[model samples]
Target: MALAHILIVEDDAEISGPLERFLRINGLATTAIASAEDAASVLASDEIDLVLLDLMLPGEDGLALCRRLSAANGPRIIMLTALSEPTDRVVGLELGADDYICKPFDLRELLARIRAVLRRPLPAQGRPRQTEAAYRFSGFAFFPQRRFLRSPAGLRVPLTGAEADLLLAFCQHPREVLSRDTLISLTRGEGFAIAVRSVDILVSRLRRKLANDDLAAEIIRTVRSDGYVFQPRVLAE
Candidate 1:
């Protein structure tokens, strides 16, 4: 079997150099790049499995790169940020990054996060066949079995695997207020471990995509301090 190919997108040689060596030593194929431009080139020409992206880079910033990746059927992304950058982390998650680790992060913890993300299923990648029908709401069509969303404008709206999971949950229970913890459980199940805050971020990301068209207004609505409600009455087709 081919080893997992990881792309390390950090401008800091001090960090990327050691990270590359460490991941390679742990039986992963590692490629290190300095800029988001070079990282985009590598991603275009390489079959990378995951990306360890840094927010600060020369020229194009990591958040912009992450947004581009979110729109593409691309590899998973995990951001690397400073310890004081909580806002960046939330923004990264809103941009569809799979995970992130604070700078000065423990190598072991980062490695563990990498392993966890690698093990998680990607959207529409070899999933088992399902009898569930496609969902139609607000002129948008979501085929859960295929793991893709089609807009009313007949364009394919890009969605991360995590976003797909969360959308599935909302479709399954439309008009119901789904709390953060309930959403985490519904999307990931009991064994799936993720922070409740992640659920909120993912909802924000999904809402952004769902509201891509001005005609499709208020598909999802926040329920004050409770959770959130999927407003449109979804119908299974």
Candidate 2:
């Protein structure tokens, strides 16, 4: 396997210096940038596989930068934030951050998250050579390659990274009751330490986006004791 190139977008030399050195020593290519603006330029000029973006920066805030980068096909982002609230983490995920590590995090945990994100299959935009596939269900079409959902009326429904991942898992295994743990593992990867409640939030968000009428009659059905299941017949091609 090729060495993964990582961009460290942290302003503090105290943090970036040792982090960059550690990553380099571990057989990864590293670039340390102090500001979001420089990070943008470096990302454009270099082939960076992942970004360790600090939420607090001198110029453009990390959240704004993450929003902009998420809108386009760019490097996978793992936000670095001091905020520990679940809402903050959800917001970051909703804005397209692939993962996040709180400030003063363990280097081992950070390295594990970096590896987990890297191990994930690259999005369609990142892997253009792969054949595109679409799944159709309940008047909605999901283009996994493009990471977008199309309504029955031919309108595009936007989806956050987490929502898209969860929806795809359901569509892939229609009618099967998937437990919270199962869903989390399928969408976020095995050994990912995310709260199961987050799955409930993603499910609610997806239902709001995909269901036109009563959510109870939506394509995704809550299976009381089992978990959740996709009620619609799904066809993939």
| Top candidate, metric lDDT | 2
Model 1 Cα lDDT, one tens digit per residue, 19-64: 9988988888999999989987898788788999998899999999
Each candidate's lDDT (Cα)? 0.81, 0.84
After TM-score superposition, what is the CA distance of residue 50 in candidate 2 from its true location, in Å? 1.9
> Best-fitting candidate, measured by TM-score?
2
Candidate 1, number of clashes: 0
Off by over 4 Å in 1: 123-139, 143-147, 152-155, 171-179, 185-195, 208-237
Off by over 4 Å in 2: 126-128, 213-216
TM-scores for every candidate against the unseen true structure: 0.72, 0.90
